[model samples]
Target: MAEPQIKDQRGWAPVDTGYLDNPKMLDVLDASGTAALMHLASVLYCAQHLTDGHIAPGIARRKVGGTKDDDRLLIDAGMWHEPGHDCPTCEQPEPNKVYVHDFLQHNRTAAKAKRASERASKAAKERWERQRAEQDTPTDATRMPDALHPAMLGDDSSNAEREKERKREGGGSRRTPSRPLPESWTPSPSHIEKCSKERIDLDHEAEKFRNNALAKDMRYANWDRAFTNWLSRDWVKRTSAGLDPMKDW
Candidate 1:
């Protein structure tokens, strides 16, 4: 397949553009990057699947592998071909430059970006759930594992085993476990204290609402009688009067 010219296309700038400092710009740029990668992926899919045409000169024809390989290429374009050859079309002459840009690179970067996103999201969710659970279940009186605790060392064996299993299954052959966050980069004790104070303030607000007149009236009111009367009389009358019984609350 003819390599698409990397002309002055809009939004093809490198990832570290200054505009990305803004969250909106970051998202827009990332989305554009993803789109470009996807377009590259489609081109690669064609290269590997459709019969190889001349790349303006010398080169072996490309062929797509099995469905699994295809899927891998689709998910992670970086995994597609072993590092070899010059760009097929431009014939850039350098071995690294001779390579085809397709689904593999695009998909690999996309997968990395997506995985990072999911990991951050999972961490945030876990933190939120922990906070909520702690409302009913207090933290252990004993000190929990600090970042440097001995239990952290024990976790290494489990992580190693998982890595081995991943390689065995060929799922994570290229994946490396992420490094721990630096203490300076992570939330500090003072941050934790501030968050705790904020949580206490929120809980106090909820308690105040619970003690408010409206809340007291609603909680102490004849809920059962109201529900029973609605169910036995109002609901029955509504149903008999040709209202949809299923919808009548």
Candidate 2:
């Protein structure tokens, strides 16, 4: 089973206490071996995924800031091992560039620890992105595009309903203007004939009335209404009462 990693948010590292109890630790009393062991142990602890140190000989030696004599002492004390290579002079193992051994026993990063740390970093990054997206979004009341009507997201039926309502209010699309007729107007001979044949006015008087109504200068939706109104008001007043349609032919 994989060991669980510690939940340390402030970034702490792990150190096993078994090294203090090892009998070999007491045997390595020399200055070179002791320093080399400490340096190798620190490198292994910080290497992240490689719980076992697989550092290069030159890099490890340089990072440890130790001498050739110190590196050699580490091998003699069994504190470090070289994989896939041999020492030339002594025919013993020598440190290779690719892999170093015993880092697992001396490091902070186990498989479980690395997994936990990665998970934490990923979760933090996701949260930050979510917040940034939300902050960048606009929340104004009237910033919508012209084409985006309420019917699009709501219901398709509403579009038909709104069109019907518009027609009802406006009496449908107007083929002709509905502007009101003027109170006083002049009537053409054709207009006079259309309204009533009984009432009689001289051609000159009719023309005078037309010119006067034109002077009034009001617009009318139905010219028929204007002509009819003029006949009722002015034509009646001008015509002789004996020529009334009710009593006289």
Candidate 3:
């Protein structure tokens, strides 16, 4: 039996309905599910075929912020190729595949290492600068002023002036104001030596006290007792204030 055939306006027979008869130009499409290989070939062919036409390959969006040639290099290295696809940059008519990791992995790794090194370098520089500044500064004792010591400068004039003022204020003017005898006054070297000896004795006592475990233990025990007492008193005050009763919980 002869099968009936259908024809189009151009006088070409209609495409076969069977799956085997209907052959697509490309065996595998892109991940976009579009038959990109055939389209790509067609685009390239049309570009080559026409002497003057808009056969330019579709341009990719340019990376704006500090665009690295590395990502573009990876693209050229065939990292993002579909099945039977060519490199867009090189126009290499070879099958190449593009992996997402290949482009990002190296860049991220380099960036992390660079960041760590920079942070470490910055920290070290800051520490060095601080130590240098400290070393350049004067010691605390040398920086302190001698004017702070009242004994170094003679300040007896102020007392003498006050005494004069007191004598003038009194209604009865005494012919002669009685004063203490200078013969009774004497600088005692023994007294000064004794005071120095006592100071040295106190320092030694402090050193001995620090060395003694019983003294340290007693100090800690006193502190703990005081803290516990304070805590108990505070708890009583807070309880009396109705803090616990007023709490939401």
Best by lDDT: 2
lDDT: which is higher, 1 or 3?
A: 1
Flag regions of model 3 displaced more than 4 Å.
1-60, 63-115, 118-122, 125-129, 132-136, 139-148, 153-249
lDDT of each: 0.36, 0.49, 0.33
TM-score to native of every candidate shown:
0.18, 0.37, 0.21
> Residue-wise lDDT of candidate 2 within 93-201, one digit each (tens)?
3344333334444445547666877898899999999999998876654444222422232334434433443354455764455443345544656765743565455
Better of 2 and 3 by TM-score: 2
Per-residue C-alpha lDDT of model 1 across residues 1-249, encoded as one tens digit per residue: 455443222212132344236454344335454433432343443343321211211122222212332333322433123334344422222332223333333223434444656787799999999988988774545333322221133545445533553454345543444332222332335434543643323233223323331322322122222222222334334444556534443
Runs in model 1 deviating more than 4 A are 1-108, 138-249
Off by over 4 Å in 2: 1-13, 16-23, 41-51, 84-95, 98-101, 105-118, 140-249
Error of 3 at 27 (Å): 25
Instruction: Give residue 54's lDDT in candidate 3 (0 to 100).
Output: 17
Query: Candidates sorted by TM-score, descending order?
Result: 2, 3, 1
Q: Which ten residues in a row have the lowest lDDT in candidate 2?
A: 145-154
